[model samples]
Target: MEIETRTPAEQLRACEALRRTAEARSLDILCELAEHYEVSEDSLIEHLVDRRIQPVVPGPTVSEFLSLELAGLLECTPLQAAAKLYSALRLKYRHPTLHTAVQQLDIEPHRALRAVDKCAHLDASVAERVTTGWLPQQLGLGHTAALNRLDKLVVEADPQRAIERERARRKDLDVSLWGSYDGVTTLSGRLEDLDARYLDASVDRMADVLTAEHPGLSRGQLRAKAMGVLANPAMALGLLQRAAQPALPDSEAPNGCLGPLCGTIQTPLHKLRPRLELAVHIDTNAVGCATGSARIEGAGHITLNLLREYLSDIDVTVQPVIDLATVAPEDQYRPSAALKKVLLLAFPTEMFPFSNRATARFMDFDHTERFRSGRRRQTRLGNLCPFSRRPHRGKTAGVWDVKQHSVGVLTWTSPLKYVYEVSPGGTRLVDTGHDAWRKLDW
Candidate 1:
């Protein structure tokens, strides 16, 4: 039981056992709850297989209220609870062999669930046949290999459906901006094949042009700069025209010429300007310091040198700094802009257990203690914390018991008596020797 004495391999085996046990326990509970409701047995209908009558694969359909009740206990939104319940039911009944393997700690539950997900659209009879036939061999394969095998089985079972799924997936294209970290934002998405190739070629072309001028920059760094260069239509068009000409040797290329045609292109660079709003909060003393850090609104922490590099050419509109010490508690329920800004600076992400790391700026500033109409200073910094809409609704519905023990420290007690401590640092499960969350035997 002493983790310090255990070898790394032993620790990993212990962790694997605990993870399987937890998932098995969760499936048991979900199946029990699903049985409480009047589950439809349509998919459970008996069918003739190899001259014997057998029950087809089945899954439960629980009442909507059950999901709401489980949401608070699970510390997740109702939609997530329902999805988990649905997946658990399918895993338990539709793939009984895999389910038993999970319960016996022979295989990971996620791998089995991945099989269930891949074959979910097939008919109950087909799904049962596929899993029952392939479960024995695929159980020992690695995660990715197992999933690939399952996908092949699904394609073999229902080729028409697989074709349809492929066509549908190909049509799903989108571009999105994810969170910023270490002074860089991530842009990711799925794109059509031809468009992706075109974009890739364009980026390489731009990166090549940038590399001719900035020899110190690496290829990856030049490619990143190429994305920004492509954003400007004037610069993009000029680069395209220059690309039509013959290639310049590395030695013959003009150094320090970032603009198109070695700064000879006459097109005005500012004709189509890209506007961006970036909010950066810094301490007064750190403004001109040699070594200090600042917090970008969407991005996390950034060093002063990196911040200067990011804002070197961009126009910055500075706002007067508010003295957080002087900002007093307000009598109104709604918090002021300054107070909200202070809270965003304090807590960068929403203050809910198992939250999706939602930015604090987009969350609802809810009072930890309910606001009374006539109470003075009810909506204050100490009493307010940001929560996403679903978590806020769950709290409002009295499903969870939330107690703010001190400023920036809160404890949440679920209906099932699962305790979680939430603070500015992070969230952690509180072990209170409760039966529900007792220490597992590893």
Candidate 2:
């Protein structure tokens, strides 16, 4: 009945062992359940697999495995449980070593995912470090700091590639907000170094306005209150429109998205002017069919039947895959303005099942031709995957080695070859990028 004391490092190591044990047990139960339902155990312990063979279609990948009881056990909504299951399978297939390391490192699943994102495009040495849990150990220091070390390691491994990757990573910055159950709202999110620095300065400057009322406010409190001020809709919007102006707009215009004045600007958004840029690509004829759906780029897909309720005065950008042209596939890297206009056409709302984030920008302009080794071929060598944004990391991590996957579609009774039959020399829309999201766990 005696408990021995352990050092912090020993405790950490013990915790990691416990985490791995729990994960293994969980996978065992899930796999057994899958067998009971005659399902693929692939959804469980998917990270252990070397290569991923995606589940067959024409049937449910989720409903067949997920139920109310399973959802409750997992502490998530039924849809969320399904999404988690699907995403686990996808990410595991993409990063077998990383997932294993995550369990071994006792890192939270989501944080481990972000680590994978940061380290996905590194040299073999860096990847080997990741597999052995050397890199992830640094994550305990802090997310940003750990990522900085990973970046430095990659740079040391390959300076030129590091520079190119940094440029791409810097170009991609996003700010988002989510609500909590506490009734009180919260504002927090990931921001890159440059933007974070700029926001810090801006918040400091704006907090000065509140100095008279609360002279006792510390720098942190000032920054917090400044964030509250920034939360004001009118203040935020006017700031955007006038960020380029001579002087920034102050607390003048209404503080809401509604008419001239309102407090809760967030609520009346569905009624007020549209703010989001929604791009739809679904055929008009098959509007309300279950088989038919519309992809709202950047947000995923919705049933075509809900089109009336979902869309009203929304402006849509369309990019249609056409029936061939004088332009060659190799020449079509970045679409020209005119070419983009012509490319806008109706496409299937979703390609892969459980794929929710089918954005126009995420589709792959995949070449059907096989890749020939050497001798000056259009190998898509330098190009990055629009979604993962990883390419040429001394291995095929971001880039799949397969030149083409033969996905058959049944037209009637017979099966047709190739993934999609885009008018021989033409192109067709594909959601290859959105099988899993970059920032989102699901």
- Per TM-score, the best of the predicted structures is 1
lDDT of 1: 0.72
- The CA lDDT of each predicted structure is 0.72, 0.44
lDDT of each residue in 202-221, candidate 2, tens digit only: 78766665576589989778
| TM per prediction | 0.72, 0.36
User: What would the C-alpha RMSD of candidate 2 be, to one decimal place?
Assistant: 17.2
Which ranges in model 2 have alpha carbons more than 4 Å from their true place? 1-19, 27-73, 77-117, 121-130, 133-151, 154-165, 180-183, 190-195, 231-442
Q: What lDDT tens digits, residue by residue, belong to model 1 across residues 241-346?
A: 5654545454444463433455446655544456666668788899779899998777778999998887776567777665656768889898989788777776
Worst 10 residues of 2 by lDDT: 409-418
TM-score of 2: 0.36
Off by over 4 Å in 1: 1-86, 137-142, 232-235, 238-273, 328-347, 360-363, 374-377, 404-408, 430-442
Looking at model 2, residue 229 earns an lDDT score of: 58
